[model samples]
Target: MDPRESLIPPETLPDLLAPGLRLISVGLNPSPASVAAQVYFAHPRNRFWPMLNASGLIDETLSPSPDSMRRLFEAHRIGFTDLVKRSTPGVAQLRAADYRAGASALRMRLHGLAPRAIWFQGRTPWSQYLRYTSGEAPAAVWGLQSQTLDGVPVWVTPNPSPANAAFPLDVLTAQLASLANWLARRP
Candidate 1:
């Protein structure tokens, strides 16, 4: 397939996920570029990978390719998933119904998988999770939350999308480092 094609591929990126992980990073949804490339956080401008490395969560930096995902899960005990499974050109393209259904499904999955902690990449997914599950849309704080998901701790951070310029890279990196520190202190 020509890489320039804007068509959403039949296949989207698969979740690099497993049960009993130390950390699970959740995204809002797949970007069209990520879908077309069949990789998570694959957009060239996306800083998820860079910030992940800077945080020192993993032993080394990882490429956002499917091939590198195994190392993340197997060695680092980190996994990835998204609140919504569908790919869109932008988050605005996602509907409320999509968030509702996705949040419900994610709740069930997290209950089953039982990761130690969940780090939501942005506020939307976490907010939708609270709204759908509890009927209250509370404002999100970008750090460890008071709530727990099936006994798993929840963390939030600014979205690393190139579109989210409000949080500087240094701030984002610091948030991730905080998360890393929290994980280290856990038994």
Candidate 2:
């Protein structure tokens, strides 16, 4: 049986790699805008770039251009991926089964990459990932901090998406700041 046929392999996904991708952000799926741009989290309203900037994770703001972010992500040794290779407009559009399946696949990739951490944004995805994984993995800040999952750290950060208005800009910045601090020590 071909395992590749059952799910979207990492190759088919819009993945980024640097000198050695130390951190890989695992998203539930690509946004429609991201798919169109072939960049992760490319939506104009998405707060991802701004959040990273405020957090100090990125020294400067990534221009709202998808192409630019790609270059930046690569330069930083940070990668982006989605549980589902396809795109959907909103989280509500996804189903429980999707999270379960995505979680299962993610564990496999987490092992393959051997990244220092697998950061998941949005609590929904994190909770779903935890549930499907059958137990706890390291929990990281906003999802931040150093913790281990099968020996690799797992960090959970606030979803920089506009949909998550609960985390105001300043608060989000603080959370990301913690993440930045952790990352700083890693290298």
Candidate 3:
């Protein structure tokens, strides 16, 4: 897939979903596999699932099936989104322009969702978002948090892309377990 092509694969790039979506989880962008798989974080090497398990966010280990993820979202009030709606195949396919555009647009989404907490799975997206704002809005940790951001909270976990070297399964699971532990405590 040509990253620069204006024609994005109609292969299921979800639009700006309902702002009613509560726990909005934001990704940096889309990969071809994710687009093709029609599931966010579907890549085999990605650590997203294990992280969720380690974090204790979910009660059971889920198969990387689209249905399971969707079920979890609906039941848990979690939502999925990307900083960029367009597919770029890989990070190298993205330009600085995409980050800037995504950042500007993402802020509007935050206000719209009014989510109790906003979660990002990567440093690029979170660090870039921080560029446009200031002063520790919430407990922005590498894992889950118990704080709020301007009333709404924000948490970040490791990006599960096979490309993100920082979060191998162990690290990723520990991080996700943090989220699970938090979820366990919530009313």
- The C-alpha lDDT values of all candidates are 0.86, 0.70, 0.69
For model 1, which pairs clash?
none
lDDT of 1: 0.86
Model 3: residue 119 alpha-carbon error in angstroms = 1.2
Stretches off by above 4 angstroms in model 2 are: 1-13, 17-19, 135-141, 145-147
Compose the digit string of candidate 3's lDDT tens values, residues 1-187: 6666745546544733455555678898877777777777778887787677656666677766778667767776678888876787687787767777877777666665676567788767777666544423333558654544456666777888888885688887776666656655665
Please write out the lDDT profile of model 1 over residues 5-52, one tens digit for every residue: 755445556787788899998999999888776777889999888888
**Would you give me the overall lDDT of model 2?**
0.70
- Candidates ranked, most accurate by lDDT first: 1, 2, 3
Model 1: residues with Cα > 4 Å off, grouped in runs = 1-8
Better structure of 1 and 3 per lDDT: 1
Q: Comparing 1 and 3 by TM-score, which wins? A: 1
Q: What local lDDT score does residue 63 receive in model 1, on the 0 to 100 scale?
A: 86
Can you write out model 2's per-residue Cα lDDT over 1-187, one digit (the tens) per residue? Answer: 7887856433334566432466778777777777666667778888777777777777666765666666667667677777655567888888877877887876666665666666777666777777778666434345553445577676777787878888887877777677678878985
After superposition of all CA atoms, the RMSD between model 1 and the true structure is 3.7
Provide the lDDT at 57 for model 2: 75
